[model samples]
Target chain A: MSITRITVLSGGMGGARFLQGLLHGIAAGTVPGVSPGAEVTVVANTADDLWMHGLKICPDLDTVMYTLGDGIDLDRGWGRRDETWSVKAELAAYGVEPTWFGLGDRDIATHVVRTQMLDAGYPLSAVTEALCRRWQPGVRLLPMSDDRVETHVAIADEAAPSGRRVVHFQEYWVRLRAEVPAESVIVVGLDASSPAPGVLEAIAEADLVVLPPSNPVVSVGTILGVPGVREALRTTAAPVVGLSPVVGGSHVRGMAHQMLTSIGVEVSAAAVGLHYGDRATTSEGVLDAWLVDERDADQVDRVRGAGLACAAVPLMMSDVDATAAMAAAAVALVTDRGSVDGAR
Target chain B: MSITRITVLSGGMGGARFLQGLLHGIAAGTVPGVSPGAEVTVVANTADDLWMHGLKICPDLDTVMYTLGDGIDLDRGWGRRDETWSVKAELAAYGVEPTWFGLGDRDIATHVVRTQMLDAGYPLSAVTEALCRRWQPGVRLLPMSDDRVETHVAIADEAAPSGRRVVHFQEYWVRLRAEVPAESVIVVGLDASSPAPGVLEAIAEADLVVLPPSNPVVSVGTILGVPGVREALRTTAAPVVGLSPVVGGSHVRGMAHQMLTSIGVEVSAAAVGLHYGDRATTSEGVLDAWLVDERDADQVDRVRGAGLACAAVPLMMSDVDATAAMAAAAVALVTDRGSVDGAR
Candidate 1:
C-alpha cells in the first residue's frame, strides 16, 4: 500500500518524540509504505487540557507543535527553547493558585491566542489549526474533542482534604508526581462528547494508523475514550499498528507503569499488546499489529498467541534514526501480515 | 475639621502620581487640616479598560496599584519595574491583534489574575481587593463601576476600511496618537452602570474630595458619567476641589487637549476649571474650588469669576516634594473655604 496519508493518535512527550522521528523517517524516505510526500494528521488528546489563569492550555498539542516545529527546549523536552518565567514569577508573587504547573513566558503566547480564539466562538479544533499556522508542525493536528474532557485520577485520600479525592490528571502527574496509588482513571465528559471536526475522518481515510509509544491508559486511552474515535479505529479499512511504550519491563518514559498498575495490567510488553487486543479477530478490539523492544523478544510469542501480529524491534527513541527504524519495523510487521492474509 | 477620610477621583498615570504625592504629604503631615493617619480611597476611571488577547486589562487600576506599591517602572510611569516583553514578542510573532499594546511579561500576570477572577464569578471590585492583598497599594482602590463602561472616541475616518469610524480610547490615544480630529467622547454603558460596591460610599463618607489633574473628558468625565457617581459628588457634604490637568494653554501631559477640543471646551486651565463649574453656587455643579499652575496664575480672576475659589500654585510634579506641595495647596484651598463657610 502507498501510505500517502498517515494518522497518529498522540499524547505529550512520548507521542511528540515518536512523531518527530516518524517525520524524519518520511523526509528520509525510510518509513516503509510511507512516501516522503506523505501527509500526517495528528489526533491529539485534550483530556490533559487545563484552564489556568483564564488561558486554555493543551499540553499534548503544544508539546507536539513545539517539538516538531524545532522550537522546543531540547533539555526540558517540552515548552519553548528560550522560554522566560517572568509571568510565572509574577503570578506566584500575586499568590495565585495552582502555581505548580509550568507556564513559560513564550508558551503563554500560545495559550493567550488559543484562549482568545476560544472566547471569540471558535471551536477548539479550529483554534488548534489557527495555532499551527505559526508552528507549521508539518502535520494537521486536531484536538480529540471541542467540548471539555478532563482525565481525573481517583486516589486514596487518608488526609481528609476539603476538595474531592479525585484530582485533575495534572495535579496527579505534575504536582504529586504520581506518588500515591491511583484508584482508577476517570475520563470525565468523554461519554457525552463527540469527536472534534476531522478526527474520525482522518482515522477513516488514513493509509495507516499508528499508536506511538504514548501512555496507552491516559494519553491514547483518553483519546479512545471519546465516543466515536475508538469505533473509527476499530472499523476503519486502514491497518492499525502500535509501538509499545513499555520496552522490556518498563515504559520507555513517563507514567505508563503507574497507569497500567491502576488498570490492573501487568508491567510487561506482552501484557500491553494483549491489553489492546487484536483487530483481525476480536469483535471490538482495535490493534492489527504490535511492536516491542528487541530485548522483549521473548514476549513476541505471547503477543502472537493473543491473535495480534507481533514483532520485536529496538524501540528506544533516543535519536531520530533509531526511532525511524522502529517506525519502519512496525509498518513492515502490519504490511507483511496483510500480504500473508491476501495469500491465504 | 480633621480630614480623616479623603476620596480622590483619579485617572491612570497622572491620578496615580498625584495620589502618591498626596499619600506622601499626608504621611509627612505637610497638608494642613489633615492627620498623618488618614484613610484614602481612590475612585479610578475604568473607561480605558480593554479586552485584548482575551484578557481584561484595566490600565488605570494597574497603574494605581503598581505606582502606590512601589512596583511601577518610574521612567515609563506605568507597568511593573524590571519587566520583560517575552509574551509581547511571542504574541507579535503569532500575529495577534492589538500588537501595539505594551503587555509586559510581568504586567501580564495582573491581567491574567484579574481575568481569571472575573471569569470565576467575582466582581471587579472584589478582584481588586484580592489583588491588593499582594501589591498593598496603600489606599482602597475602587473601580468606578462594576458594570462594563468603555470609552469610545468618534473620530473623522473617511478612509476607514471596517466598522464605524469610532475607535477605542486606547486606539485613539496610542494607535492614532490623537492626530485626527475627534468628534466626541462616548462613555458607552455608563448610563446603566452603578458604582462599584464602595464607590458612592467613598464619596459620601469622605472628609474631603479632590479631583486629581486627570483628563476631564475621559478619565474623570467617564467616572462622573456613571449614573449615580455624579449625583454623589453633587450631594456629598465634603468640600470638592479639583486640580487643573491643563497647565497653560495646553495640558500638563496626556491627550487632554484633544479630548477638550473633542467636547468643544477650550484647552486652557481656566476653561477646564469653568467646565467643572462652581459647586458652591451652581445647584448641580460638582466642583467647589479649582487650582491652576503658577504659569496659569494670570487666569486666577477668570476662574473666581466662574464662582469657584481659585488658587495659583506650582503644579509641576517634578518629585515627591514638589507634588506633595501641590497636594498641600489643593487641601489648603478647600479647608480655607470651609472655615469661611463655618464662620458665616
Candidate 2:
C-alpha cells in the first residue's frame, strides 16, 4: 500500500517543524510506505487567527509557510528569519493596545497583503493560496475553514461579575504566557464553520493522514471541529494515525497541558490517544492508530486496550533526522495494521 | 503690528523646513514683528495624499509632524529617522504594487494607526490629532479638508488615444520622476471639499498668514482650490504673504518648476510672485507681499509692479538660522506695509 497522497492536520511551531521533517523523509524516500514524489496537503488551523493593527494575521498558516519555505526564524521557531520589529516597537510607542504581540516588520507585510486581499473580497483560503505563491512551501496549504473561528479561553477574574473573563487564545498564550489557570476553552464560530475548499476532498482522497504533535485541543481539535471534516476523515479510504503531543504527563511544547486540563482531559500520552479514541469502537473517534513517546511505552497497553494500534517511539523532534524517524515510525505502525477497516 | 497668531498653508519637505525655521525665529524672538509664544496653525495640503498598500499616507502632514517633532529623517527631509525598510522590501518581494513609494517600517506605524482610526469612522482631522499626540508637533496641524482630494497629473502619453495619461500626483512625482511633460493638473474632489474643522477659523483669525516656499501649483494651489479656504484667506483681516518657490528662473528644490510649467506659469521667482499677484489688485489673488530669492533681485521690480510689496532675500534654507532670517525678512516686509487695507 504505497501512500501517494498524504494529508496532515497542523498548527504552528511544532506542526511546522514536524512537517519539515516529514517532507525531508519523503524526499529521501525514508518514510516506510510513502511513494516517491508523493504530494502532501496541509489543513492548518485558522482558529489562532487574529486582527491586529487592522491587519489579518494567521499564525498557524504563516508558521507552516515560513517554516517549509526556509524563511522561519530557527531560534524562535516562528516568524520570518532575520525579522525586524520596527512596526511592533512603533505601534507600542503610539500606545496602541496589544503591545505584547511581537509583530515583526517583515511579518506585517504578509499580514498587510492578506488583509488587503481579504478586504477586496478574497476568502481566507484564496488569500492563503495567493500568499503561498511567494513562499512556495512545496505543499498545498489550506486553512481549516475560510470563516472566522477564534479560540477564546475563559480565565478566573475576581473582578468580573461572572467570576470569569474570556480572552482570545492569543491574549491567553502570547500575552499572558498561558500561566493563568484556564477554566474553559470556547471555540467561537467553530461549529458553524464549513471546511475550506478542498479540505474535505484532500482528506477523503489521501492515501494516508498523519496528525503531527500539535496542540490537540486548540489546533487539531479545532480543525476537526469544522463541520464535515471529522466525517471525511472517518469515511476516507485512508489509514488515520496521530502522534501524541503529550509525553509522560505533560505536553512537549505549547499550552496543551493547560488546554487539555481545561477540557477535563488528563494530560498524559495514553489519555490523549484514548481521547482521540479508536475509530473501530466509537462513532466519535477518528484515529486507527496512535504513537506515544518511548518514555510513555508503559502506557501502550492502555491505548491498545481501547482498540487502537499503539506503539512507542522516540517522539522528540530535536532535529530533521530525529523527526523523520518519528514520521517513519508513525507510518510503519499504521501500515502494519494490514487493513483500513478500523479507520473506516 | 505684532503678529501673535500665524497660519501657514504648507506642503511636504520645503514647507516643513520653512516651518522649522519659522518656529525657530518665533521661539528665539528673531522675527521683526512677532509676539512671544505666537501659536502657528498649519493647513497642510492633502491633495498629494495617496492610499498604497491599503494604508492612508498623507506625506505632507507626516512631513510637518515628524519634522516639527524632531522625528523626521533630517537628511531625507521626510519620514522617520532611523527607519527600516523591512516592510517595503518584504512587500516588494511579495510582488505588491507601488514599489516606487518608500514606506518605511517606522513610518508605516503612523499609517497603520491612522488607517485603523479611519476605518473606525474617525475623520482625518481627528486621526491627525490622535497621531499628533504621539509626535507632539507643537503647532496645530490640520488637513486642508477631511474629504478625499487627490491631485492627478495628466502627462503626454503617446500610447493613449487622447495622447495623455492621468496618474496620481505621487506616481507622477515619485514613480515617473516627473520626466514626462505634464499636460494638466487636476485636483479631484477639491471643489467639493469643505475646509477641515478649524481650517477656515485658523485662517480667518490669524494675525499673519505665511505661504512657505512649497510647490505653488500643487501644494498651495490645491489648498486654495478648497471651497471656503480661498474665501477665508481673501476675506480674512490678516495680511497674507508668500515666499517664491522659484528662484533665478528655477525652483530652489522640488518639482515646482515642472508643476508651474504644467500650470502655464513661468518658472521664475518674479513670475511665481506675480502669478500669486497683489491681493489688492484682484479679487482672485491671495498675497499682499511676495519675497524672491536674492539671486532674483533683478526680478523684484517685476513683482512690485504687480501691485504688491516685494523684496529679495537669501531664500535658500541652508540652515535653521538662515531660514529664520528669511522668515524674519518675510515678516518685516509684510509688517512694514503698515496698513492692512490691501489684505482686507
Q: Considering only chain A, what is the TM-score of each predicted structure? A: 0.96, 0.97
RMSD values for the candidates in order, in angstroms, are 3.2, 2.9
In angstroms, give how far residue A290 of model 2 lies from its true place: 0.3
List model 1 lDDT by residue over A129-237, tens digit each.
Answer: 9889999999999998999999999988777674349989999999998888888999889999999999999999998999998999989988988998888999999
lDDT of each: 0.89, 0.91
iRMSD of prediction 2: 0.5
Writing each residue's lDDT as its tens digit, candidate 2 over B1-344 gives 77889999999998999999999999999997898789999999999999998999999999999999999999887899999999999999999997999799999999999999999999999999999999888899999999999999999888999988899999999898888788899999998889999999999999999999999999999999999888888889999999988877778775667788888988888888777777788878889899888888888777888988888888999999999988888888888754322221
Model 1 over residues B1-344: C-alpha lDDT tens digits? 89999999999999999999999999999988999999999999998999889889999999999999999999999899999999999999899877888899999999999999999999999999999999898899999988899999988766787534888999998889888888888888988888999899999999999999999989999988888888899989999999999887888776678899988899999999888888767765799899898888889889989899888888988898899988988988888755322221
lDDT of prediction 2: 0.91
Interface RMSDs of the predictions, in order, are 0.6, 0.5
lDDT of 1: 0.89
| All candidates: DockQ | 0.81, 0.88
Name every residue pair that clashes in candidate 2: none
Error of 1 at A238 (Å): 1.7
Cand 2, B chain, TM:
0.97
Q: Top model by TM-score, which number?
A: 2
